[model samples]
Target: MSRDNPTSLEQRLSVHLQPLYPDEDPARMAQACLEAMELSPSATPVKPHANLWSERDTVVITYGDSIRREAEAPLQTLRQFCHDHLSDCISTLHILPFFPYSSDDGFSVMDYTTVNPALGNWDDIETLSAEFKIMGDLVINHCSSRSLWFDNFRQSIDPGASFFYCAPGDADTSMVVRPRTSPLLREVETPDGVKHVWCTFSHDQVDLNFENPDVLYEFIKIIRLYLEKGIRWFRMDAVAFVWKKLGTACINLPETHELIRLLRLLIEHKAPDAVIITETNIPNHENLTYFGNANEAHLIYNFSLPPLLLNTLITGNCTHLKSWLMTMPPAQFGTTYLNFVASHDGIGLRPTEGLLSEWEVDTMISTLQRFGAKVSCRTNAQGEPKPYEINISLWNALQGTAQHGPDTWQYARFMCAHAIMASLEGIPAFYIHSLIATENDYERIENTGHFRSINRHIWDADALSDALQDTGTHHHKVINGMRRLLEIRCKQPAFHPNATQFTLHLGESLFAFWRQSTDRRQSIFAIHNISDQPQSLNLSELNLVSTDQWTDLISEQHFEDRVAQLELAPYQYMWLTNL
Candidate 1:
């Protein structure tokens, strides 16, 4: 980037890609462009209320449910929940993967056409999509090995199939079996004489070869049809691994990026209403590449945020979050982040960029990885630490049924984490189960043959909801506390963007940031302490006149900014309104 600046994707690509792509054949180049289409095909209809993103502004509660196997069950709850928590503030609903998928938590989608029958019928999806203005997220990166696409690719490589990508004769067998860091690995097998085929996470899940133009075309068709049915967002699952060429890590490939661009183009040309949000579980710098100058995805899931939030809590720091903020380069002014702390998945150690110093990261992530490793815990009659895996010690540090931080420190810290999130640079999203504190650390659902559904649970949602509905329960206290922050955030104008300057007081574990809209019409500031101990701040350095008198939205509490320091309870947050 210094003296030899590469101007185009092809130019930047040629250096490392010449070995694979060879020359720029127009056909291949066109295919590459189609793969990352910025707009949908011209044949696609431009319908209303389909891709309303920034205009359809809402502070949504994004729940990463597997699918609509039984739509009536969750759909009903979703409708009700929407009306209650999100109806006014959130106009768009993101139901993650309502279609049937393979064991890898539905990323191995079997059929992209309809919601799996296990969840509900096609009619149910239509009903749900029609009943209320909601956004449905369809996973479109990989497919289950059992899918018709994979069947054709292996047992019957029919040219007219218009579905799967068949390797040229011996290519499938020719590819090597290796463990690649990236999720998409080329893996197929010769099962009892009939050679099966695919690029996949595992042998069970097969990746659709987008290299085949027909496969690309059919995938686009699926997007357009969903647009007709009111699906507003398509989350590209494992999207970075879409294009694979041996040797190099098959990730963030030029072709993969091109594919997203083409999809965006086709969507813009056809539907023009729905938004494409890429689910690249990478760091802020890498994730921003998904925007492709606003030609790829309209939004992206801030996958680093959850761990970033939790890390800030455990380490009593905001430096990493602030540093990442400075490095995040979004495509345009209007793009937003689908922000949340927890989703359907476990806390992934991703975005391993400059979040922490190399030594610190190695120490911290090694510690986290150790926490996740299999461990047998034993306790004495008095219930204290005994012989166990190192994971248990680290796990307990995160409030695993034992006192690690302080009394109610975990709960208070957790609540403040959410409050701070709700006040971050983007629309703060909450996983419904996390609100009620669904702390099911029951790890081994994978052993019951439901390997992928290990973390999946119906949840004791009714009890939590009812308790919150009742005024006196702890559930009410927690939910209302979260509700208060959310309700206040909705009224303020500053938190609408995803990129903003952060001001941190390192000693107090406090973070402050203001998102000033480009037009300067609105600005919002969030103040938070990640520490377990009570902290205070003196803003004489911040140059605010009488930092003493300011409007605090969270509890409707007023503060008088004076030369004297203002006190903050442990894990307290302030939503301040000012220029």
Candidate 2:
């Protein structure tokens, strides 16, 4: 425990454990943690000098069961697809919730130790990890009521009864911030009697009680097991609601942050190169809190990006998006935003609460509805439901614009959106559905009775392959366009996660920004025309270097002569670098 040898695992564990378990013996707890760490599997080697946050780190967010075939395991097909198509462009595979689950896709985990048999086993995950960096969802907030832990709780077992939050049937829960209209306290039949348990998302997904140190220990053991299987990246699903307390909002609470910090310290202590990204789809101000004094999440999801991008493209105005971008919190020393346009979930509207006005949000919602998007709502503190997210593929969400139709024009607009996303000052991530230009799946939604099914599409491997291989299809075009942008982005030092960014106000319909690398050796000026018609840009007014020759990294086209004023085609973007 001396200063010179500060990294002794026991000392580090003592420091973290003492804060959470002050009354418990630190040595005993530390020894128990060491034993848990020792039981975890050994990690497979990745790259030697790999940095978790880098321009080279591009994540493809997909479900383990996203792709399927007639006779083979879905993961096998997925691994083969990544190798065949995405090996060159994507750096990490963020497979969302592959664990054995009862509901909510894979969020309602029934077992943390095993993968769903339909998706194959841990071997498939290891196979995928052997090729690319893998990210697994640590669904730490809640687990299925049917899980063994919950079953043990129902049987009044010691550790399992303490694993979840259970209160008297008449406990006051009026102050809880509700993300859904469902009752906060769900009645469950236990051996002792019927008790009310905390169910944040749904009745089946029981919230874990972190006030009990054993719950934290259980999650740590699960994470260690994942690390041993070569999962270097973990998306802490619904992490903001992990530690709940009555008479409070129960979201982003201090104790929750402490838990995150503890997990971060332990992960770093064990696997120095591992990453933990928090998935808190809340308001912009509250979401960033997960980066707890640089001790929590390695990356926080940029929830504002999806809605803001849609607003900019739909309204043909850059005011809201640009204003928010300018005021965005600067990326700290070891953390950055996980900039994404879409994911397995819908486009979150909560992040834009203060940024977009009520009228603006309504207008955007109506526009998306016209383009075949569905809106899901969440209850406010006063119990009135409001729009929380838009359920549709990002491509379709941007398709309602009058500037472009449903085919190539939509693809061009989609490419324009991603161009800005990649050029931003953070690691860019793409949802698998977005990469292939999928639209809202109305049939799936009707069949499953799941509102989010609109954005979650299951593809047949052979059919998907055919579409991707055919150059004329929209799927082929979108995938290729995204790949080209990602390839260009990964090679640019200015796109580093810790780069300094400055917003450039070109016009109402023109969105632009400049990224200067940490080393100052590279600077990139990214400009986008969100309008349906061509827009003229004046370089002099923006105080840019008035150069006669400026080259776009994406198109590789040289702009000569009239560099002071240039025209951008409808839904076009340029990553310009001065030579």
Candidate achieving the largest TM-score: 2
- Minimum summed lDDT over a 10-residue window in model 2 is located at 40-49
Model 1 residue 340 CA deviation in Å:
2.3
Against the hidden reference, what TM-scores do the models get?
0.78, 0.94
The per-model lDDT (C-alpha) reads: 0.56, 0.84
List per-candidate RMSD values in Å: 7.7, 3.2
Q: Which lDDT tens digits does candidate 2 get at residues 58-150?
A: 999999878899889999989988898889888999998888999999999999999899999999999999999999999988999989999
* Model 2's TM-score against the true structure: 0.94
Encode model 1's per-residue lDDT on 1-579: one tens digit a residue.
221564343333233333334454544544454454433122343342232443225434344342122334555555665567555555556666667777655556777787765555556556666645455655555677777667655544563233444344344332332222232234444332443344545666666666655666577667766877776667677787677665455568788776776566556665556677787776567777887766677778877777666677767777887666556553365466777776655554455455756565445544444334322222322334322221211122344111133346655776777776666665555665555444344354544343223334454445546767888765567666666556666655555554354555445378776655545555455778777667877755443445335566765665565444778887787766553
